[model samples]
Target: MLAVTILGNNSAVPAFDRHPTSQVVTHDGVNYLVDCGEGTQIQMINYKIRRGKISHIFISHLHGDHYFGLVGLLNSFGLLGHQQELHVYAPSPLQEIIEMQLRVADTRLCYQLHFHTISGEALLVDNEKIEIRCFPTQHRIECYGFTFREKRKPRKLILDSVKQNNVPLHFYDNLKDGEDFITSAGEVIRNEWVTTAAPKGKSYAFCADTRYFEPIIDHIRDTDMIYHETTYLDNLRERAFERFHSTSKQAALIAKKANVKRLLIGHFSSKYDTLEEFEKEARDVFPNTDLALEGVTYRI
Candidate 1:
């Protein structure tokens, strides 16, 4: 599993019972916070997300709605006696901003907080299980989008075949790793005869806080799912362009052009009391589009 849970979906201000921008991307039992907007902690608690499990956080920009809750969340982590080291990736200015806030409060977290500045296209994280890369997005200020790709899993063991081959239980792990089994009779049991190919890993992209950026299509191309911002309805295309924001149709167009498996639109403007029109317009172009409602989990 690869999945994303929407914590806050509104833009600028929280309104119409919606929150600001924040979300959690979960992969292989690890959680990656995409943004920490206002009230993000509250949303996490309400959704039963374990804050302690979050080892990394990615902030797209310095916009208040994008990261206002980060300080509070870190404070709460310290108060909660969290001892795990946490890594945060964002623009360089954010390090100074956070340090200033912590300094003013004379606050020091119990856990070590590492900050990695994102300036352009960069590989933020790479491990045996996952790869995370960031790319710049067109915005009024510095901003970035992220792509999460899961490494392929090991081969799956067929219980009956393994048992038939007289493979010992202790060697099950080796079989899963595609190693041939050596039986007590000194017979070589082929790995493929007892194991099957693993399922293909999934990929997800988060196109955070951008205008109608055409260049972004290359970064998000052929992803299993995409989370794009739709701060306004299609009718307000000009206004959206002027404000360096995106309309639902524009988001859909990007998804369509990128050939993503699915598109999720959110970061709705507080001006719109109803969201049905936003969903309708995006789906008009990309039929697989869905609204990124708060607390909802969309699997990739």
Candidate 2:
């Protein structure tokens, strides 16, 4: 159930029916929002994203395109009577910015709102079901990328083996935890003999606005999938580098170098009227690349 729904994928400006940078990473019914660009609320409504399920929001940078819709969304949450405690993680100065906006409007939220200032690479959230961490990205301003990893599942029990071994019901839990079982007579049964290892947890990384930075490969290596910004086509490599952005080929190169299972490229520049060439160019280098189309849900 680990997936990300793209709300707005365009970069800087919204054009050609595309919005700004925003998305929702959904895992096991809980939603973690990443970036709140302009028109984020409208895009969420268009995509049918359950705003109530979002308990945490991660803003990558201070750029207007990345956070212009944040205060509005927060205000809407109050108006909508959202009851869950809300947590926001971002770099410095965002708390000050949000407070000023809230103060000017004199809007009092009904629910508890928490803001966490991200300092360098650190673990943001680690609960029973998921672990989320942030790493720095090479953006024009201070920016960060986020990694969402599902917690490793418990080992599955072999019903026949447990029944044949006469293992007590109370010992089942221990077996699932990969613990060896001992009988009253001091007979030891290996955990592997009664249970199979659970599947490895799925993982996804949101590589917020960045250039062709190789250091990023270290943090995103071997992820199930990653959404990297391809702000320009291959021919505009120079322009992308100058703008602190990445081209389609560059994004694909990152995915290939990181050994990710799949790559989702978005954050397209407004100059491009069509995206077919972007996908084709990226796929040339990384066959598993796909366009991060708005309103599309990509399962990791």
Candidate 3:
């Protein structure tokens, strides 16, 4: 299963009981953190997320709201005796920034931490279960967005059919791999006759802070779901453009253009005390749009 749990949904500052920016994308029991903003660890604890399962972290930018809580979390992992190696992917200057913080504090992590500097479009992780890639986004400073695509599962065996064919248990793995079985007499037992196709894999995209840019439509096209930032209401279109941020309507338009199954709108500006208007505006354009509320898990 593929899902995203929102840990923080606010932007720039924490206000009205909302946090900055952070989320956990979980697949097959593994957790991948996206953007560790201030109060992220607290939010994780509040939501009961398993911190030890997180092996990778993807940071979009160096904005304080996006990464202020990273060092603290890393420190806590050491104190807790986390043994698994941790991997962090982000743009440059972040590695330098984080190293400085650790150095000044004279901190040493118990687990190995690997830093992968993101530049342009790059494949960050490709394993048996999932494939993760990063793409550049238009922002005030260098930033990137990530796409997580789960790998297709193996076909399922038809137990009764296999038994009727007298197929041995030793060949069950091959049957699941879609391979045909043959008898000593050369009688072929077609794979499809005893197995069913697996379900299609799911995909999700995380569009970091950006303006109303259409180029991203190509990267996120036809995704199962996407989390796009809507830092302002549609009424503040001009101001949003001036500040390199997107309005609610703009995010909806992108989701509509990309033909995504669902659109999650968050990264809300602190100026708005209420969020109903943002949801209303985005849904006006894309009916499937939903607010990315904290502590909520949206399954893909």
Candidate 4:
């Protein structure tokens, strides 16, 4: 099962009811923390998220609202006696900042910490079941978004077809790979007679913090679920543009254009006390849009 849990949803500052940006994506048995804002560890605890299960942490940009909790989370991981290897993916200067923090504290982590800086347009991380690709997003500073796609297995060979046709067991592998089998008598066994294509897997996209840019539609096209930042309402459109952020209506447009199944919008500006307006604005444009409430879990 693939799911995303919202740890914090507020944009810049933590309010009494809302928090800064942070989320945890759970795919298979692995967990990935995206955009560790301030008080994220406490947020994780409040949400009952298993911090030790997170193997990777992804930072969208250097904005404090998006990454201020990183150092604290890392330090807490060490303090918790976490021994598994941890990987961090972020922009260039993040490594320097983390290293500086470690240096000042004179602390060494218990696990192997790996840092990979994203410089180019796309960075791919392939595993046995899931593949993640990071793409550039238009923001004030160098920023990026991530696409997580689950890979499908090869098609299954039809056992009844093989038995009825007297095909040998050794040729099953070829049939599963969509290849025709050749017999000793030079008979060609059609792939359609023995195999069927695998079912298409699902994908999730996180379009962190960015302005309304049409180019991103291609990268997030037809995603099963997309989490985009809606930091302002339609009335604040000018302010959103001035701050290099997106309004709820603009984010809904991207989700609508990309044809995503569901749009989860968060990173709301702290100025708004009630999020009902944001939800109404987005749902007006895209009916499937929903507010990304803190502590809520969304299944993809």
Best by lDDT: 3
Q: How many backbone clashes does candidate 2 have?
A: 0
lDDT of 2 by residue, 30-80 (tens): 999999998899999988999999999999999999999999999999999
Q: Which digits, one per residue and each the tens of the lDDT, describe model 4 over residues 1-300?
A: 789999988988887589888999998888999999999999998988988899999888999999999999999999999989999999989999998999999999999999999865675678768888888888999999999898876788788997887788887877877888888899988888888888877889999899998888989999999999999998989999988899999999999999999999999888889999999999999999899988899998
Clashing pairs in 4: none
**What tens-digit string does per-residue lDDT give for candidate 3 at 167-224?**
9999999999999999988999999999999998999999999999999999999999
Residue 77's lDDT within candidate 2 is 98
lDDT per residue as tens, model 1, 1-300: 999999999999999989999999999889999999999999999999999999999999999999999999999999999889999999999999999999999998899999999988999999989999999998899999999999889999999999888898999889988899887788999999999989888999999999999999999999999999999998898998988899999999999999999999999999989999999999999999999999999999
Question: Could you give me the TM-score of model 2 versus the true structure?
Answer: 0.98
The residue ranges of model 1 lying beyond 4 angstroms of the native Cα positions read 158-194
**Candidate 2: regions farther than 4 A off:** none
TM-score of each: 0.90, 0.98, 0.96, 0.94
Superposing all C-alpha atoms, what RMSD in Å does each candidate have to the true structure? 2.7, 0.8, 1.4, 1.7
- Misplaced by over 4 Å in model 4 are 166-174
> Could you tally the backbone clashes for each prediction?
0, 0, 0, 0
As a whole number from 0 to 100, the lDDT of residue 85 in candidate 3 is 97
